[model samples]
Target: MSAHEDVGELVPEGTFLRPDDSVRRFAGGTVLVGGSPLWLLKLGAQGARVFGRWVNGGEALRRNAGEQRLARRLLDAGLLHPESPRGRFTLADLTLVTPVKDNASGVHRLLEATDELSERIIVDDGSVEPLPEAALRHEKPLGPAAARNAGWQRVRTELIAFVDSDVVPETGWLDAILPLFSDPEVAAVAPRIRSRPGDAPLERYEQDRSALDLGSRPAPVRPMSRVSYVPGAALVVRRSALAELGGFDTRLRFGEDVDLVWRLAASGHTVRYAPESVVWHDPRAGLLEWMRQRFEYGTSAASLSARHPGLLCCAKVSRWSALSWGLLASGRPVTALATAAVTTALFPRALRGRGIPATEALRLAGVGHLGAGRILAEATRRTWWPPALVAALFGGRARAVTSAVLLPCLIESAGKGPSWALLRLLDDLSYGAGVWAGCLKERTIGPLRPQFTDDSLCRGSGRRLPASRSIGSKAGRTCDRSRSSQRYERVGAR
Candidate 1:
């Protein structure tokens, strides 16, 4: 399907959109500077006028097909976000499916929380005591993916909501999410998974940074994006889309949700993360349980990598960024500084016609390098920690470098105190150990691989924008009747 059709023919009227904070207007609002990986979009005069109208009104109005198309492009570019949808859907249109093993109390809590939903089905995956409320039962333990497939297969509603037994959704949780389904392209949407409140130190830590929590940002869920995947803990999906994909893969005992989401995107369907909808999930019973959960999560990397190749990459950095960092790490400070200077100088030359100032180009280069350092540090902690720890134990220099790499993690737990830092270290170690174990078991090192991208900039023009009303160019001439007038130039990282 075409990209336009994948996102929808037109963004529905009355959809509220807000420009991303990073978006900056230049050249009398004709040029836009922002998006994931960042880019420069040069709009035609008419397109700019339509954008200006949306910017001023804070809502998308269907004045013409051109305006709707422009709004859709900005949204797909990540430059604009839908603040809310004017349409509404009800719980009556949804069937709740819960997969459980032995958490009857959790089942009770979940049922109590979502009492409004009439069609609730529980899949009992071989619990010691069979649940009387179970609509489907397995004789032996099948993983969550299998159980969910079983439950959702029997669902007859237009929407199927797969909410884990452990979650208790907050009131009005559907208000922000149900409206999103108005876009037929949106296959699934997940809510923010927050840890249930508690005073224990572990509970406090989990509350602050739960693995399931995707933060407070609304984003189109895609691999390697700011928000990659959402947990299946609380997700509502269109019945037809899930059926089209044949539901979740039962082979993946863990990370099945990630696999399902990537498959949806691969199949040209949209998945989204809506943080405005909140669902409370109970944390692990204790520290060991928590560590085990983290370890299990890490183990899924190998299988996920096998399913979707480069998406599991530990880090992706530009050649210049990698060279500069490598030189610095190898004790060549002077050479590293020179490399950085050369990179900054070349950045502006590459984007010569984009109208960006030389100083701004230098700033972007610096920001890119800093961002690269953070990515490398995270990669070290997440995938290379085993080797990093071994190196740290032998030499003072190695220890120093490892300590520098670990500073980010410490800074993340700053106000939480030294004890929290220790937990953070343990967390990384446990997760990394699981990664190593999974790699050995699967005999694949794909997850450990780092992807390097070219630093050179490339620009192209085409009639790639969705078709609609003709937009007038800067020269006050209407576009060719056969093509679109929405011209854009990609400026920064790929």
Candidate 2:
């Protein structure tokens, strides 16, 4: 029934919980069953949390028979063995919540792994076609926020692990995570993610760089320190933690995890990074997709900055650069020249201490400028349809006027100061796209069926990640063999 009473019955006493459970406690406070750190009470709290509004975030995944079975099994196990050291756990299912326009190759592997988990789910988040025979539960067409909320509502276990469909877990992934709940205070757990191979070189490089950059950051175990945002790709959260925060903010299109962590920290919860838990992701490939994603990110960042002024300075550069590029892309030679000159003048500030390859960084800067230009061009066209359309289709007087009015100002501003402005701009755009796409039917467009044939994305096709043996052996246990060169042709054979 009630959480406290339910938890009180599980741990009668005298249980040595796993190491992670001991290490993850919130501010060194232990989780108790019958009012002390034990397995039963922990399990009970986990179960109660899974069925309520808190578990709504994971509804889609739990709606599928296969996924639901997994959830049921995990919940059943928790209910039966409330104090067992190995049995205490929760399931946080992650849904990508992106349009079906593109299929990340690693999705199958994620599904494959989910089948093995004690509690597994793949929330479709209103995709064009229900995830290839997986049949994720459908909910109203809401964005990521609602999808996550639905998921949280379906939780039937003590811990909820959110793993994106695009991310494949390494063998023993959960082996490294579940025990952390033994500590009552540890509210959340995040795993390390590496980019899967077989992705485009640029995509791989970006993913690797991001993993390296974010992976090294410290995880906050203290109530006072803000936990680094639990990446949505692979995060394990306690049911109690989810309830405490009241689930993800349905309003945020981007940085929802960051906001969640900020709130959790503000509410005095502990979050830890379990490096032992590994997930592989192959991020989007192609320059256009990358740029689009980044631009959307910039919009979200701007929204965030508007609310949190600390982000304003960082976000300004991207916005300014985008608007400037919009001007230059038009036939505004004078403005382009002035902006270029001003941008060149500001080169010193932009270049300071950045370790990224000079060429690559410059390329990104150029893209940012071009994206801003595109946005401004779109705005202009939307406002004055005929002239803007003509100017867009064929260079015209208005194009020159736009460049003249905006270019000099942009170039001058860029030259005067270097802010992490480009990054902010990209963040805003990516986030904005995510939000905007949520509303448009065209955004959900995907192939009538998977475009890539089995042969196309299989091992010999050069789109596979390295494969390894399962960490432990069990009858009928499956490993995602698609990426293994040895088993390439054998996919679907078993």
Candidate 3:
């Protein structure tokens, strides 16, 4: 079939719509049959405000390129403003721009994220199924990057927020972090990730660790050079700034988030973590699934280290050392025997007390250990980020520690799966580990230093500060004059 033939459907008849902001006419001819609704929007180059539709369908294309359905209509419409004053973007929530796919639970979670975003658009990433009550916006199989670009181009808002398909935004997320953009120098902000409740123990543990890394607690403030990459699960980026950075690196299979952050930093733009902007992700439910995730993460890390050879080589060495240490520490006959016996006895407690059936708890523990090993293998394959290796090698150990700490709390949460207990342990251990590791690294290189002393995080605050400057604050913020004052713009033909 011709590429354009894959345009599954067209806009609905007499679609009820409104014309606000940059749009002059709600044209019906711009849509295709069997595709999603198409609202051809217009955004003036300057002085814009928010403009978009809460669209649904099998995904809609901005413009057709005959046989090339994936062609970028938005990018082709405008020239890059390379010299535009680049700033970071901050999103209050995830913007899921894909066709509705099966996996009911997954879709429900996506819907949760959609509710979180101040604005959201579902591009219908070309679904074969009939459109739901929510029409698809675009139907062509534009790769995510192309769709994202097209979506941004259609955005009348000053910023673009991106969220993954499987993530669910937490409550009070947007209101907590939306004001951080007052600085304008802050171009982007990524959210903290937690585990979805009702999943298996291992999944819960994985999410706990992820959330602790980016939560509201005081994190170590190292030189900007010391900061690592951000995850894209829930990232808000400035539209103009991302356009300047060339949007998402479509070429990457993984590390796209890292690549984007690295490029933003290199360009002298600031990328911050909005701890209050939180999303809970559903981690792989079983041990084998977790292993698959670790392998992919390892492969991505290896490739990343190879590219940044100087900075990453130490991480590689650290990985090997940590692995050897883990095996030596845990695989000792005495230790292994003790762990086996303890683990065996604990199975009953886990079943009765932790709400996990005895069979499932034991099964998950075994898988969790195996998954940790896979993460270790991933670390060894990488050249740097040795701590991550340690995390992998001993992740099961951490899980064991976390679970031990959680048993009481699980019993206390009254069958809540010890999520709170797990979170507390992770907060103390995982985040504490990052802070300690960063500090140790600094001690070797020198004292931990600030990347931008003039920025709010480091300047004269006697008390520990939150990671985000404006998240969760109740008062209106004083706008900084050194940056742009543009608001969300309307995008359509006026």
Best by lDDT: 1
Tens-digit lDDT track for model 2 on 322-424?
4345455555668875664455334323433222234533443454455445444433322223344456466666666554434433453364333323332
For model 1, residues 1-494, the per-residue Cα lDDT tens digits are: 22752335666667777777778886677778777656677676566776776777664566455566666667766778775555656788899999999999999989999998899999999999999989999989999999999999999888999999999999989888888887766889999999998888888887887899989877788887777888998999999999999999999999999999999989877787888899999999888988998899889999999999888888888777888888887779899999877876766666555556767767777888888889988888878988888898988877877888999988898889876787787787778778888889899998888888655541122111223433334322333243333445544453
TM-score of each: 0.92, 0.44, 0.44
- TM-score of model number 2: 0.44
RMSD value for candidate 1: 3.5
Q: Each candidate's root-mean-square deviation in Å? A: 3.5, 22.0, 22.2
lDDT of 1 at 418: 78
* Better candidate by lDDT, 1 or 3: 1
Per-residue lDDT tens digits for candidate 3, residues 256-313, read 6676776776565656665556777767666555544544443344344344333332
As a whole number from 0 to 100, the lDDT of residue 196 in candidate 3 is 72
Give lDDT: candidate 2, residue 455: 23
lDDT score, candidate 1, position 23: 83
Which run of 10 residues does model 2 get worst, by summed lDDT?
A: 485-494
